[model samples]
Target: MRAVVYDAPGAFSVREVPVPEPGPGEVRLAVEMAGMCGTDVHIDAGGFFSRYPLTPGHEIVGRVDALGDGVTSLARGEPVVADNTVLCGHCAPCRRGEPLFCANFYSLGVNGPGGFADCVVVRAEKCFAAGDLDLGTAVMAEPTACVVHGLDVLDLRPGADVLVFGAGPTGLVLAQLLAHGGAARVTVAAPTARKLDLARSYGTDVTVEIDRSDPARALPVLRAAAPDGYDVVVDATGAASVVEICLGLVRDGGTFFVYGMADEQLSVPLHPYEVFRRELTIKGSFAQTHCFERSLALLRSGRVRTDGLVTHEFALGDYGLALEATRSDRSCVKAAVVP
Candidate 1:
């Protein structure tokens, strides 16, 4: 087997390694494709709870190569998506029906060996049948699951006017989810015209191309679109400055959802008086929990499209290049590694 191994932070290499075997209740998957995103970039920099000497790919789709003892629900050669998150059922959060906040959280690729290899083993229950979805689309299951969880947290109301910031893969997906999930009109704001153009096809009713460094310059344009402000404002850009701007766009008594992953040390000023006077609601959503199946179902049903979302693909040996592309390549929306 071949794998991209991270021996330490800011260090990695692709090398041949012995194939791993599955234990009881687990199955070994022959890696087909693994999706790379900003999270991978963070992991490469040694943040995001990443464990060293790890194979860093969390969004994965592969074929069942071998099954371990007691695993009869799946068979060899079946295509499936991996749910890299492993939760301890006995944890306080798990017992409270909040597995996302599990006290003992272990996510592959983040804190363990993952799918950035020719082969990897995961619990059989974590494997979701990809059905007939192509590798490109199936590999999106993890991200879509995160979007699903975000929507779940938002609990959006039907016919509400929505505004989303950022047009990245997750941002576009979240926009589509908001568009179809119940928002009467969904608007996307981003600095890139190309991504804004793509968002139009994914159920975005309006697209605003704002200058990232001077977002306020476009406020007049945005206000012209929604003079009363949006019923729900979301920041999917993960930039604290962007989030700060987005918070001011929420209508009175409306909700503001934070769906982007920002720097841990970053802080944004918030006026508690404004929130109190307006009776506003603020929410945040992290990585998913119990949403993988729904994401796959949405992809399979064509309700949530993945077209043009995966703009780049790389080979296993070019894992470093893939990470770099994901980190700095504005041309690359989503990068996939075909191991």
Candidate 2:
């Protein structure tokens, strides 16, 4: 089977590889549609860690082509989505019920060969029945699950006013979940007017176009939209500059969530005095944490729109162009690889 393999940093190829088969307590997925995410871009650029010659895709939707021994709970030929977390139960973090931070943490897409192939072998427990939706929509299940985890860390209060940075796929999903979590007002800020319009269609109360290079001008327009400040302010741009600027936009007692994946080498300054004086809560959310079922339900119910989110998709052979669309195209919110 042909799989997208990252040979080294800034290098990849769709090479023919052996088809994976299910092992005990495992299941083999026949790749249908896999979502290309920001993390994939980072991995390609050598910013994130990954085993070279890796099949890089975590957000996946496919059918159960085969099931391994002790995997009777699922049926053959059933459509499904795979969870990427693979935790060693004995690890301290797992024992503490926080597998996302396991001392020996590994994920399917990032740590090993994952969904970007004709077939992938995953633990049976990690495969959930695909929601009652088309492949394109079901592909969002993984990322949506991560968004649910972000909300988990946030502990949102009802009727809270919220402002989010970046109107990309993750930011837009965050906006919808905030609305569902009972936030009274939700505003999304991004560099693109097209995405801001997309956010509005998803029921965002306000949308602001931001020019990160000129925060002096953009910040004022954003501040005027909510003069009192917001109960929750989030940076989803994953840009160090944006994250640093978003710190001062939260209300005195409000919280700030770092929902974006910034480069590890980047650093920003924070004022300790202000944090002490205002009682601000700054938190960061990582990968999906066992939220697949609820996320799939929301997507299946049409509460979260998938219409414009998947702006581009390519066949397995066109993987090169697909990667380019993700980086060079500002209009491309999300791209998928269909096999």
Top-scoring candidate (lDDT): 1
Q: Give per-residue CA lDDT, model 1, range 150-224, as digits (tens).
A: 999999999999999899999999999998888999999998898988999776999999998878788888888
Cα lDDT of all candidates, in order?
0.91, 0.87
Counting clashing residue pairs in each candidate, in order, gives: 0, 0
Model 2 bad stretches (over 4 Å): none
Clashing pairs in 1: none
Per-candidate TM-scores read 0.97, 0.97
Worst 10 residues of 1 by lDDT: 239-248
Q: What tens-digit string does per-residue lDDT give for candidate 2 at 1-339?
A: 999888887888888998887889998989899999889888888766687778888888888888899999888889899888788889888999988888877787787888888988889998888747887788888889999999999999999999999888889999999998999999888888899899999999988888857644578887887787889999887888788778688989899899999998988998999889999999999987689988888898888877888999999888888889888798799999998
User: Could you tell me which 10 consecutive residues in candidate 2 have the lowest summed lDDT?
Assistant: 209-218
Model 2, residue pairs in steric clash: none
Cα displacement (Å) at residue 61, model 2: 0.6
